[model samples]
Target: MAGRALLVFLALTILSSSVLLPKARGNSEGDALNALRRSLTDPDNVLQSWDPNLVNPCTWFHITCNRDNHVTRVDLGNSNLSGHLVPELGKLEHLQYLELYKNNIQGTIPAELGNLKSLISLDLYNNNISGTIPPSLGNLKSLTRLNDNQLHGPIPRVLAGISSLKVV
Candidate 1:
């Protein structure tokens, strides 16, 4: 009976681990998003609902999540926000659209953003952003539109190979 109980305990532990793993990873995404929330200055309180204590960002306004609760879109355009973008933004593994246009945000784009392999549209247009675009952006095979930011410096040569890319 002792051996049987031990086997059951181990099985339960393994089962629980499988369930807990995604929640932990999901929380990391929430943490990453919250990190971004802390970095910006929301003068209009548009991001007022981005409460980090929440179980996940899916409940937050302007943030869209997939069926699995993975964050997919972050729409903060034209909301009178300022401050620089954070590297934690790259941790949104499932993110597709990142729209931060028409804000007063200033500073160099974090090259870590290139880690977003699933990004489709990245519109930082009409912002006060500066600095060279990361060459690692070429890793975003799913990228379709990246345009109209205040970015300077010669475009990375690797982007020329991505046929799906349009507009910059």
Candidate 2:
């Protein structure tokens, strides 16, 4: 009886952990999105559609996710979102594409964005963003596109040095 009870206890522990793990990961992803929502100043409420309470952001419009349920794309181009880019955006570790073009965003490109090791395309063209191009952006080895809109500064030498650059 003692051995049977021990086996049942172990089984329950394993089951409980298995159930909790996914929820923990989901909560972390949700927390990251919530942080992103807080950082931006949504003046026109364009992002009002992004409600964390309604459902997972993965199912929300303009958001794309991978099979592992990680956010991979955020395509909000030409949506009239006026705000400053926040450094916390770097928290989306799995982000692949970020399209916020043709908006009115104004501010320096956060250096923290370099932390997105999985980032492929980062389009912010036709906006009011200003400041020096961060050299850390070179850390994005996976980056395929890096478009800026009216951004001013001495282009980072690292970017200039990249042999893969098809256009500047």
Candidate 3:
């Protein structure tokens, strides 16, 4: 009888773990953004209002969320943010819109940002960012709006194939 009970307990533990693991992974999305925030040097204090302690980034300034409570938009245009874009920004798997235009951001556009498969619009215009636009950005098949920036490189042919692309 004790053996049977032990087996049942083990089964229950496995069941519970399987149910909880996805939630834990999903929570990491926000944790990843928080990590990215910590990496940035927010000199202009524009990101001062960002409080990671707050329940969700969606509730933070210039952020938006979808019905699933995942971050969908980040509009930090003209905020004078001066820093490097962290690769951790790629962890936002559900991000659809990212607007960081007209800032003092300087650095290579993170290749990891191409991991945002759900992204539809990305506006990085007028920033000081430099480097070759990642060929990985071609993976953003959902992208419809890509704006001008200081990006350098021969345009990737994959980007040219995007049926939804309008401007780059």
Candidate 4:
């Protein structure tokens, strides 16, 4: 009952945000963020500021963008969030840091995240996530940090392919 209502509320909010974006600075990044926002169950309303109508997501809270308006970081650690991670996050070409630790996120890490060649850090510790670590993670050539999770299966040898990888 309550859960269903929450879902409805989230859907309505996103719908409202979508309707406003066309008249604002809407772009692909905003779309990606919208996907991410949709995937999350934000009970604290921390993501309320993530308005897709903005042409640049850089101005949104917990999101950092470069001077070129490219999203570089997403610091959403420990905000009492819960939900599955969407594959749309893989679209942040210039993203360097993706900190999503200490939440209740579940599901597999999307293989598409391997596309984040510019990523330097991916912190997902202390979560309820399951499934094997994606072997595609070996593609993060610049990755230096990876930490605690509830993953199963063998660690991919390709992960060794990342010369800069330090933590696992």
Candidate 5:
């Protein structure tokens, strides 16, 4: 009976850890998004649902996650949010779509964004963002859209490496 009880206890421990592991990983992404929320000016309270207290950002409005609870998309386009992009945005390793277009956002783009290896669409068009496009963005092999912003300076030659890039 003692051995059986120990086996059951071990099994329960493993099951509980498996359930909690995803939440812990997801919380890091949640922290990243919350950093962005702090950097922005949400006068419309559109980000009101982005509560950092949640176990994961998956439950937050405008945030999408994959089956693994990893953040995949951030659909905040035209939500009337302004403010500069935070380097913390780069921490979302699984982010695919970062839609923040047509807003009044101002300031230079964060170069740390180059760390997003899985990024596909990064729409920041029609914003007040200014500065040279980071050559590091060339690292995004999956990037497609990166245009219509108020950026200046010569386009990085390194971007030619991205065969998947369509609109820039």
Candidate 6:
């Protein structure tokens, strides 16, 4: 009888952990996206679907996720979004494309963006963004675009090291 009870307890523990583990991982990405939602002034309500109470940001509009539910892209270009970018965006480890062009977004690029090892394209052109481009962006090995923003200061020499880079 005791053996049966022990088996049941173990099964319950495993079951609960399996269910909660995914939510825990999704929460990090969701929390990061929610931070961005809070920072932006979405006049068009493009971010209306960004509800933090949801299980994950994968269900949110403008956010793309992989099979594992990790955010892989953020397609918010020309959506009339304004407001400075939050550093919390750097938490998206699988982010590939960050399209926020043609908006009124201001403030300097967060240096923490260098943490996105999987980033491919980072489009922030035609915005009101100002300040020196963060040199840490040099860390993106697959970056294709880094142009047309209001940034000043000598382009980071490190960016020249990346062969995938097209326009800087």
Leading candidate by TM-score: 6
Candidate 4 regions exceeding 4 Å error are 1-26
RMSD of every prediction: 3.3, 3.8, 3.2, 12.4, 4.4, 3.5
A best-first ranking of the candidates according to their lDDT comes to: 5, 6, 4, 1, 3, 2
lDDT of 4 by residue, 1-168 (tens): 999999999999999887855664448777887898999999999999998777688889999999989889999999999998888999999999999999999998999899898999999999988899898889999999888999989999999888898899
Q: For model 4, how big is the CA root-mean-square deviation? A: 12.4
Residue pairs with backbone overlap in model 1: none
lDDT of 2 at 166: 50
lDDT per model, in order?
0.88, 0.78, 0.81, 0.90, 0.92, 0.91
lDDT of 5 by residue, 98-131 (tens): 9999899999988999999999999999899999
Q: After superposition on all CA atoms, how large is the RMSD of candidate 2?
A: 3.8
Better of 1 and 2 by TM-score: 1
- Model 1 collision count: 0
lDDT digits (tens) for residues 14-116 of candidate 6: 9988876664444988998888888899989899999999888898899999999999999999999899988998999999999999888999999999999
75-97 per-residue lDDT for model 3 (tens digits) = 88887777778888898898998
Give candidate 2 misplaced runs (Cα > 4 Å): 1-23, 41-44, 161-163
- Candidate 1 yields a Cα-based lDDT of 0.88
Instruction: For candidate 1, give the lDDT of residue 16.
Output: 87
**What lDDT, from 0 to 1, does candidate 6 have?**
0.91
Q: What lDDT, from 0 to 1, does candidate 4 have?
A: 0.90
List, residue by residue over 2-103, the lDDT tens digit for candidate 2: 999999999999998888566544555556666666766766676776776744578767789999888899888888777788887887899988898888
* TM-score comparison, 2 vs 3, better candidate: 3
